[model samples]
Target: MSRLEVYDLEHNYVTTLANAYNVGYSKEENQLWDASFQLPYDDPQLKYCRPLRFIKIYDNEDEYIGEFRIWPSEKKKSMSDRQVKIELLDCLHTLTDSVLFGYYQLNNYKTDYVFNWLLNKQKNKRWIPGRVDFQRGFSYAWENENGLVDALFSIPKPFDEDWIMERDTTVYPWKISLVKPQTEVTARIIEGYNLKEFTVKESPQKLVNRVYALGDGEGVNQLTFKTINNGKAYVEDTFSQEEYGLIEYIWTDRRFKDKASQKASTEGMLRNWKKLQYTWEITALDLMKLANRPSNLAINQGREIKANELRLGKVIELITEDNEPIQFRILKESKSDIDDGKANIQLTLGNVIGNTGTTIADVERQQEINTNYANGATNIVPYIFDREADFSNPVEFKFFVDDDVRNVNTCELTVDTSHFRATSKGNTSSPQTVSSSTSSAGGASVQSATSSAGGASVQSATSSAGGSSTQTSSANGSHRHRMFSPGDLIGPLPETRYVAYGGGFVATGSPNDIYTAEAADNHTHTVNIPAHTHNVSINIPAHTHSVSINIPAHTHQVSITIPGHTHEIIYGIFEYANLPSKLKIEVDGNIVPIDSTSFERFDVVPYLSKDEDGKATRGRHTIKITPSDLARIEVQLILRVFIQSQLGGEF
Candidate 1:
């Protein structure tokens, strides 16, 4: 009889009981076990549908056989007794069948980290991390529609390995390992031992020499495949070509979107195909009889094995009675007993064939290619800068890059300038004229005359009134035409006549006669009358004659003329048509040339600090794009890059 211990999901111990259980596992289906027990009809603790309760089966020597999770049970009732039939499943059921309810998105997270995160979400302490050494990071998204098991299997593991769930008896929690075949064994029957039964079988239906593994392609949801062949050479002896049957498998993970991964998967399938061409079934009892002494009994030497020694995916050697040694891989195993002394163990194994020539180095190289070049850290996302930018002020643009990027030398940038014009005008002064007048006058005159002459004269004399004395007449031989002077005709001519008479008495004989006529009274009257008449006639008059002179008033005029005008100016106009001369570009605080406005696939290496050992440190990195002396015109920029990390690979 085997000792069975029961526990809850939290690993809290329940009760140890003596019972019989039949446990089995198969590659095609989930592992399961069944047991039955009787309890009192009114037992208070017995119940159904209790989740997470489990059972551990151990043999009589206190070695572990297997662990099982308990499911709901069916109860059978009699009048005095009741029996409960309980079914259990392998520990893997929690991973595969349990529903995961939440949103899960992995953004450039390593595959091992993602796996650990999923397990932690279950809130169960049973499952813990083991040998999860994958170097690549992946991006994925899922809703509540997937199980943790599906999500884990969907990731691309490095080296084309498989995940195996196992428990370390010394530790409290179960562990999962990304593993390959690491151990081998041989099963042989002693010649004088009791062997219950053994059988060897070969099935041609399982033989394959060619394989095609389908995987993710470059396009969205696209499918692609890689093919592997055993040989392409013809047989020299038979002069014929050999052909092996084809087997196809599809890897639905989107992470296998590279040629290297596809090739590695196809080769892994070819390796499996070469190993599992035949099947072997072997059953034996726990006890056997010794050949020499028929009465003496001995325990079977190779009947019972340790749990760790005979687990699934382990390789072992089996030699049959015909003395043929066959290397086989254990695909299924079962142990059963019914509370009897005898215990039976059964195994389903497959034959191991030659190697498929696929090595760990090849698989690792393929993994590196996928991680570094294809579907890895390299990225291209479209972005746009402000086309209508204010160039006068400093125009700055920003973008983000992953911390894993090794060197950011692979980048590109581009730009363009704007168009249009402006103007203004003013005025200062106007037009004018002026005039004046004057007048003056002056006059002067002079005359002179002189005369000297010889003259002939006649003389006459008259006497005034009152003197009737003598009228004198002079005659002389020498007198020439003499006229009487006023002084000479003085006083009286009579007196002259008397003196003449007296003197002439003695005088000369020449004289002759004298006449004395006196009209003195009449002459004096006439002279007075003449003076009165002349005074009467002397009367004068004053008068004015008609005269005319004409003059008039008037005006004079002056004028000036002028014309209109204007002025113009331009603003924010660029110096050059194609590229601005005064421009500077700084990326991460480093200056770059702006000779070309449009940079086609230009590369910029980001400045990353290193340790003293000259190894690059991984963290958040910054890239600042600043354009200098830009204004009024439209500016544009475009960019692209690649990222890589050394974190997980080194560990």
Candidate 2:
């Protein structure tokens, strides 16, 4: 026979003494300490009562260590002595708490606290199995499709994450309780009354049996609600502060399924549980209280309010104040599949933490390792495309590495097609030495194009003296002889020698006060044209010039010849000399119009005519002028004209 002792806490006021020992202890720790006194006295307390005693041990410094206690066990639980000792040791640390039991701090203490204390604080299992005594004609179905019956349960406020399903033989998946026994529900039906205005403390308990209330002409009714057959039940409980009431619930078997179902039932309860009341006093009070609060109330407000950190496929958008979906994916980070923001996410090339060929799955798995290696750095974005992309929609994504924020958008993602071609070509090029017909026999074998004969000359002559002679000679020669000389071409002069030209042509005097001299068109003049270069200066107006020749100072133009082709270079018309401007210039009878007049004055080197042996020949060059072409020139002055007159004159 086993003996026991009981300290009747509620009856003997022993809670005062128990409270003294509960100092600085958490609920778990306190439960352990409470077990030392309460465990031996469960079930038939009088039969298990005994006088319990304990010996307290103290250190040399008078600090408490622990105590040894003994009592009779009401429940003969089967466990090895070692397991019991381990349990006792765990219980012993509860007496000390973290402050005194610092050495025995459990692994993952805070996580465990969150799991056991905070997360497991509340439980709601919607499925409830209750034994029913169907009086004769009544039939009950366990898995009813339409759900003819409902099982309801209650728990305190707040919820947790660990209410998962597990197979159990004896216990129902849901938490169970008995509704307050033999409750009398008295209901009064009033016409034209606000249902929400009813109060639990003041309003008569009405419509007790059914899930909803229906009122007709009946003034009032009394309904008796009793707990059915030793199972969980719920009464018409009203929590006005929380704005909640009770409703019919569905029973389920799986604990997790019950959890979800219970939440739906509670929400339904709050929505449909209407009450009848004659006054709107509570609603008025609520209105008054709401009005007294601050104005311009807002949370997570403003437009284009980008996220501090966004994962790949994090549909960034302009949401209304009411959280309505405005548009589809505003931006795409690389390798994201989620269309909505509410999904598991990974880093992408477009996000702050760039996706570096690391797939979303890979990144998530290796996040800890990569973070450790990089010291919490966001990895570089992978090169998804050699070219840029044309991001059509606008999206702003901002993220921080510590305090440094990075932002990217369509501007950053716009693909550069040129880069892709370059890279692809480079990758495919053969490494072997290539020989092409374009390459000179004496030169390094390559196939790059050359614009002039100088490159060809040097390349061919390279086998002899490495082409140093040809390179220097060709560069200087071509530059020195670009235009034709007098001897290069023998042509008849035009019938008209000089054309009438005016407008800003200031020559020693005005147009009316000019002097003319006839030294002789009489003598048989053999004109000795010099073997010299032709150089001229002309200025263009700052604005567009008309053919009128009447425009003043700013308008200026001149002409020069190169290889029978005359190039009329213009200056001063700064506005007409932009990159896209067209030059409608004409020289002689040939019309050569340069789109722009921005060129500076430079010499057209005399063209040295080559003999059969490739040596240059030089002589005078006669330039013809025409009236129709003169209107296009903005010349200020025609300078440095050299002509020779001889005995024959026509020679």
Candidate 3:
């Protein structure tokens, strides 16, 4: 056993008693009574040989404060098997009061809580300095002047919820819990108001879920108060809370009225529409396009009509000067939206005419007569006097429209045929010889007389070879030059060629004469000359290109001409007057005598054969004219001889 002493060194007896000897003996066994003499509960030297006792401490709040233990020792089992029970011998009044006064107090050692001890050198427990100990554990150490005897131990633990500590000794408190409040709703509607009543209830953070309300005339209705994020629910403006609460208090409540009842009972307004018809005014003119010759009347052709106001289903009247008035009816409409209320309406009317009863054709003829008066009308009627008269003289006429609209005016026709008269055989121009009733011996001409009316006259003249004649009419007026009638000789004929008779023909070269030989049917009309002639040239006169040669019994007439030939002998068929002949001939220019023997029938032959070299010569030729102007020749011997002359060999 070990003895742990607090302060007095003279208390070594207690130490020796507990260490070397058993101090107490039992009478029954003859052993010591109390001291086992192992070691003191508190001893500085024993503590050096004792093992430490580790102690864990926690506060009242179950928070791990720290650790406490005895100092280290040399012997292993010495401190493990030892126990030191602390005790108080005599409690000092001051010490007890100080502790009871809340400064210091007895504390029970707990397995889960800590106890702190205060030690000072001046106190009785001076040898034992300060300590923090675990519950149910003891440790000891005597006073040491220069050692840290203070110790702490901790149980292996985690702190409880809401537990906190400071400096391993102090304790603190937990925070308080909060509470939420509930809410309620109320609603109402005033008299004559159209809205309903509503009610609601909820906690500040909870949903009201549903609301109830009553509608006017329609009874009560159920409404829901759906919540929003801000912990609010809104009822419709028409709902009052009391009515809504009444509805929620009672389950079944009317929410709608019958459709027929509402319609018949409810107050509403009426509406209507009206229709009208009106007239329009016009102050300007309009026009319409119509077809050609629209009416067979004397209206202004191609002229446009001027109109004023036009209305639907109305009659319109218009007049034409020198004609009758026309009435029209509006028949159709146009689409232009004329805001002036005047609509463009199509109209139809009858034909219009002019004043004269004459037809339009008659008027046209009168128009021509008004243009050329001298050629208009003539006085063909004659007087009955014996001397013949000529009354078919020219007379002029004029026309006019009468002043009376109803009557057609007759044309004022007049003639000045003072050129027409008649007379007896004895009447004479001299007044001294007037004995009209006695003898009609001399054939007499009457003088033309004039009338006051627009009139015409004709004159007659009579004459005898041995009878005295009296002349009348104008005997001294100007006269027109007389023209010569045909067959009257105007000049002496030339002895040479002249185009006097049927367009004459010219002889090729200088022939025998211009007259034909014998003037009979001369088939061998000669270009009379020496024989074996090569070519003939014919010269045609100006404006006399074509000449007809009559072969008394041939099928066609053969005509020929020359186009400005130098010797008037170039020749080809020029039958049609429009086709003038063109001739190419090699002529002998020597002038020959104008004898019948100096002429020849020059037959045209085509050149043939070559002159010994490779050059190609002419073939036997047929004289040709343009197909449009081929003429037949009456001299067949000359024609055949011309065709055969193209052969080159001696034949």
lDDT per model vs. reference: 0.46, 0.23, 0.22
Q: Is candidate 2 or 3 superior in TM-score?
A: 2
How close to the true structure is residue 41 of candidate 3, measured as C-alpha lDDT?
48
- lDDT by residue for model 2 over 1-651, one digit each (tens)? 111112231212121121111111111101122222223222333232332432232222232323322344333345431111101121122112112110111222222232222212223322243322111111111111111111111111012111111111123232222211111111111112211232223343422222322111111111111123122233234543234334343321111112222333333333323333211111111111133423221223442222322222233322233335322221121111121222222221111111111111223323332232211112232112121111221112221111111111111112111110111111233334333334222323333443332211122222222212122222222122123332235343333233343433323322223223222232232334334443444444333322322323242233433233333444332222112123332222234333233233322122222334222222322221122111222221111211111113244
| Better candidate number, 1 or 3, judged by lDDT | 1
Error of 2 at 405 (Å): 18
lDDT tens digits by residue: candidate 1, 1-651: 467677776777877654333333233211223433333444544542255576776655565656666766667788765665556666655665554554345766776787787777664556677776465655554445334654454454323554333344335587765434434453332323434677767665544455444443233223243212232211011111144434433333334434444555555655555433455666744332122423222223545433124445566555456766556666565654423445455667653432212211234434433343333244564555543222454456555555544324344555544321122334433432322333232232322233334444444444343323343454334322233343444433333333454235322222333332222222212222221211122223443344343333434343434444333443443432333444455665667755754455555443334444232344433333333433323333333344433235444
TM-score of each: 0.45, 0.14, 0.09
Model 3 score (lDDT)? 0.22
Q: Write the per-residue lDDT of candidate 3 for residues 1-651, one digit (tens) a residue.
A: 212222222221222122321211111000011111223445454543222222222222232322222232222246455534221111111111111111111223342233223223223331221222223322211111121111111110111111111122111111111111111111111112211221222222211112222211211111111222123222221223233222112111111112211111111100000011111112212222122312222224543422332322233444433325334332222212121222222222111111101111133433433332211111121111111112122111112221111111121111111111222232223223322333224334444443333333434343333323343443454334333322243343334343433465543323232343223331222233333323334443333133334333223333444333233343442232232132122212222222221123432222222234222222321221111122221111121110111113465
lDDT (Cα, 0-100) at 348 in candidate 3: 25
Candidate number achieving the greatest TM-score relative to the actual structure = 1
Worst 10 residues of 3 by lDDT: 266-275
